[model samples]
Target: MSAARDSKSLSGIAINNSPHVQQLQKTAPPHLGLVCITFSKEVRFRTITRTRYLQLPEEQRETALKVLYRENLQRLDLALTFCVRNSIRLYRMPSGLFPMSDLEDEIGATVLEKMSADLAKIGQRAERLGIRMVLHPDQYVVLSSDSPHVVTTSLKILDRHARTLDLLGLPRSSWSLMNIHGGKSQRADQLVGVISELPENIKSRLTLENDEHAYSASEILQVCQRAEIPLVFDAHHHICHENLDSYDHPSVAEMLYAARETWANPDWQLVHISNGEEAFGDRKHSDLITAMPNVYREVPWIEVEAKHKEEAIARIASAGFF
Candidate 1:
């Protein structure tokens, strides 16, 4: 495919290496997303943990919260602009984009109001640039858990993510997906059941992904098919999953084709690509992607989970792999 429109500077938010981005224009359909952090030294993103915030002296904590939130919001704005310039069509926004927004009830409410304007503006920026946004809710969102406490906590975490999207003005639709795993449970039925209980707003944005540990491509596909959730087939994770048996399994190409069936508009289908650290199923991510699955060339979008971020995208571009 032809490259996207040229990215003019946005609000003077300096993108560190846009010249590199411009040269790596796409020749195809599956655009790559740089997972969260960038290699840009001028724009390092920061996030704060809830524990550290709680441990601070009450007085000292107040200023600390606003500073981190402001910095991250500004970073989010810059990242979207970077994607536009880089021809990076997709972006998996950091799950921790807003620290402790839902964990501390009193604080979350205050922070949300302060962040409303920036969030709304950036959401508009993403859509206008035609940059698809993806949010992979972190390990903390365990909706499949049986315990009410864990499930409740997980709900809060998800709500926080959904709320962020709402403020950002992304429609509650597949245009922007909130991709996640099946969580710590093995029972596909349990996960499917949990999907039934979710609010439509959250459910609408949710897309289940197959992970290396708990969920395999087929198992998660069962949930997707049953629950009507879109499948985000992870090529590396599918290779490394624990469920492959002595019996023959489907090839990566076949599984990806099957997963693509879950999406309504096939053009928006997404897949995750990452290289294993040492061997095929190791959870650790390689700093750079040596190669990508040929099947992915037919797919719509990809999120590269490499430690080197933008450099990895440049690697595949320079090689003309896609």
Candidate 2:
């Protein structure tokens, strides 16, 4: 395989934050997945909301949280083992891997201490096995939110993600992407200033992505240029809504090229793919991909969003779009 295209990259990894996945399977028993539940037992991930977690009795909270954190790390370790077994190189580490991890600095420090050894083991295995870990935080984590409280919370959440990568020993670079969307319509200056002031660990791996609403490829490309951060152009999101005419827009390829240019490494440049479940413009993701933009042919790490998770990836691999 050429350096430009990894055969492993050809087999896109799976993530389960999509609403459709949540709708299909309500969480199963605790014996099945400890505190969190998964769409499939094989792909264990998902977390209780902060509200529910806080509702737990004070005496039971720490013990409950300890179980959640420990099992999450175990699931992650198993995820790496699964990757090595399948020869897959790219995996999206679950955003809520540690439930309420971003609650506060003291809480984060205490939790990190408990799992430092597990983190090191997982990091070493990922390094030894050649896997690339990336993250797309919860949609509610918006740096562009108009509210100062929201902005501060987003900072804490993002800081937790960066700290996780640091613990895992992933490079402080886009190669270990902490991808998030420009989900709000706040003034560019405010958003850019917040990004500019981020710690080097967070800013170095930070990536901005276009969304189906609010921010478009053109809008985010400009932000990426200004922030000097990589842009993860989601082809389906771009097709659903953009200033440019849907798929046939000649500029789509140019946008992909420009977004690709934002990344420091060609091999680490990322893109996202998902098709509508019902109609072309429907925001809901389909269980399997029916088509892919030809323009993404040369892009590396095309993260697929589908309800079926890895099954969709297997179908795409056999379908021969690449």
Candidate 3:
């Protein structure tokens, strides 16, 4: 990689209340974050299926959890180090770090507590380093499912996510959020109701995002307002769902500003940036962002949720887009 530009010339975009953000405001680039999966070959998770791990005998299963959790934590440490060296301060931690952690009974409290303590150290290091950590559970984590069983299962997944963040010692605030789209548009009202019922731990750190098909930014904004949670404005998703004739349509700018206001703290505002594929304007993220709505350029933090990950960010940096 080429030498990073002087931090003084970088945007003083702050995210989270950590002093690190304050520190970076004076010496770091704009608050651009990358989603999980590093492009560099520093460290990687050799993940396993929950089923395969659970199929083992009780004693063996417990051992597997310890081993897997330890490896993920170690890899996470190395990944954070890589981010620091590369001038990447914001990162979305993978939800798969502890596969099927919702199975607390099977894993046993002793093992779970140990894992949590270990991971908390990583979170502390991230805080100390001024990196903002975040998470986005998979699409299957839908809290608004009409089926009672699906809703119950969705809460379990959310509970697991909350427990993980808590263990990492991340602030239960917009700074360290778990963002998800409004599940199943027909149940939008039900979704808002269910969000109200969620444990404060889960609800407080949660952020609602507008998806490509089910909900437009306008619609999701209402849900976020009702639930008193922040909104993540995805430029690509907005374009796909908004039916705009061009990416620079006025509605894009309107939604961007509207979503930014939903954030409880101005510094905590985050937006998702990506490009759509050609067919049907499919939501598949392109390798590089050639252009973006002008409004997106003003957000404090933008997570590049593209297929190319760091390479896409590198392209943006190389193009002098940030």
Q: What is candidate 1's lDDT per residue for 1-322, written digit by digit as tens?
A: 1010111211121222433211112356578888887876634678777788888887776577788888888988888878777788788888877777886545754777677898898888888888888899888777787687988888888888888888899999876888888987577887888888889879998999998888888889989999998999887788777433211133566677778889887778888888767744466888877646655666778888898899998886676555
Candidate models: Cα lDDT each = 0.75, 0.71, 0.76
Rank by TM-score, highest first: 3, 1, 2
lDDT per residue as tens, model 3, 1-322? 1011121233322333433222112223457787888766665686778678767887787787788888888989988998898788899988787775776474633565777778789989999999999999888888887788878888888888888888889988878899888898878789999999989789989999998888889899999888889999886788788655445555666676677678878667888877765532567876766665544556678898777778888887777655
Candidate 2 vs candidate 3: the lDDT winner is 3
Task: Give the TM-score of each candidate.
Answer: 0.85, 0.84, 0.88
Clashes of 3: 0
Name the Cα RMSD for model 2.
Answer: 10.4
Give me the overall lDDT of model 1. 0.75
Task: Give the top-scoring candidate (TM-score).
Answer: 3
Q: Candidate 2 versus the native: TM-score?
A: 0.84
- Which regions of candidate 2 are displaced past 4 Å? 1-39, 243-248
lDDT: worst 10-residue window of model 1: 1-10
Q: Which scores higher on lDDT, 1 or 2?
A: 1
